[model samples]
Target: MASSINHHVMERAEFDRPVKILIVTSPYYKDIADEQVVGAKAEIEAAGGTWDVAEVPGALEIPTAIGIAERMSNFDGYVALGCVIRGETTHYDTVCNDSSRAITLLGLQGLCIGNGILTVENYEQARVRAEVAEQNKGGGAAAAALHLVALARKWGGPRKGVGFKPASDEIQIAGAAKGPNLA
Candidate 1:
């Protein structure tokens, strides 16, 4: 499913420049975040795009970094990678909801922000889903980001910095890749 989605193919001049993408991860679940990082890195490099990584305290900080990156105008796209497992209290809900909303806003700014955040019920679930070496969603998210860039460039032509097509105006993602999609 994920692997099959054709991330846009552009003409030589259309993509004359390899994209610059940012992958920011949270270390709250060190092992999981590490895996996501690896998957995303491999995919980005495989596609001939340049990726730079940034470390944050926890998943809560992911949106902030994204906001910073969004304002920078340096990166053509962003991959916000993190693992937030549900705990005994409502903390998980707060983190998940808040981060999700933030990512939505970021995407609306006309910049492609691929959300690879993992919200699970337990550590085991996180471990399995964050299959950095296998189905690392980080890689999936990176692929999405790049695809969006291809779309943006096509619709508006090239620009000096990141671009976005509003959520209301954006193309349907084909499937539920933005949700609990894992393939």
Candidate 2:
């Protein structure tokens, strides 16, 4: 049996805002990550929001990509998607720890970041969650980013001319002109 989180969750307005998410992944795991990306894209599109995809060489690059995405200011959130299975070395620990730390820091700075990367024991475990037809974590991460974007907009204090409208497609913010003025 599963427990419900209804009492602990926020209202729909918490998830109704348009979101912009960035997905960063590892090229070494493309075979696995491809499924994740597919799942994430489907979820993002279906959720009535827009997103952008960025492919990095490896897990080590997720942090930097997030930094660049943050600077864009158009993205309301981010999603870090990757898979790191344990190998003969201790590299798994290093990657997981470092990436988690970097992501956590971004969250602390008020950027909604959804971490969907998998740190598993083997390929078998990773393959199950990365399935394109099933419950892929990539989709889960995208959902998380959307949810947090809702929550962050609520908690991100106040902006004078902010609009809570959901966007139709990927929203790329360029240089801004001010808000509407009325006398």
Candidate 3:
């Protein structure tokens, strides 16, 4: 199994300026969610970063909350935490796929996000992954976000004004300003 193999976790990345991370979590599984939050907080703090958290009703809302925060807040990055276990019905697939896709779309839009939402077969698996001493998926997610932030800072922000630019000497007409013969 993947867990049986040894893996290396990189050291916490350094940033020139302070970083603030927003943690949006779905607390439907309160215990698992809490554990994830704890691990995420520890990792961020260890990297000389600060974090704020918001709770949502379910996994699906986690991404939406982050989207809102991205628009309304000045957070440097986001950490998404939640747990969705397989159920007898197909609802599990919906939650898992939608939540993950939303997070990916946000990331593609230049928002640094670390997705820690656990999609598991059972509660036992979720417990193992969420525990701070075990898999610590929350911590891993935070670290992922931190690395991305570091890379962004290194390259400066995304390229701006990449498209065509109008000639500075070109005359521009305003509404109702002139007829074609006036020029």
lDDT of model number 3: 0.91
Candidate 1 versus truth, CA RMSD in Å, comes to 16.1
State the C-alpha lDDT per candidate: 0.80, 0.77, 0.91
Report the number of clashing residue pairs per model: 2, 0, 0
**Poorest lDDT segment (10 consecutive residues) of candidate 2:** 1-10
Once fitted onto the true fold, the runs of candidate 3 whose alpha carbons sit more than 4 angstroms away are: 157-183
Which sections of candidate 2 miss by over 4 Å? 1-17, 157-183
Selected candidate, larger lDDT, 1 vs 3: 3
Best-to-worst order by lDDT is 3, 1, 2
lDDT of 2: 0.77
**TM-scores for every predicted model:** 0.75, 0.75, 0.86
Q: Residue by residue across 14-119, what tens digits does model 3's lDDT show?
A: 9878999998889999999999999999999999999999999999998899989989989999999999999999999999999999999999998899999999
- Model 1's number of clashes is 2
- What clash pairs does model 1 have? 110-163, 110-164
Locate the minimum summed-lDDT window of 10 residues in model 3.
168-177
Candidate 1, 1-183: lDDT as tens digits: 344555553432225578888998897889888888888887778778898999999877888997887776588888999998888999999999999898888788787888999998888777766786555677778777787777777887555657874555243564444675566
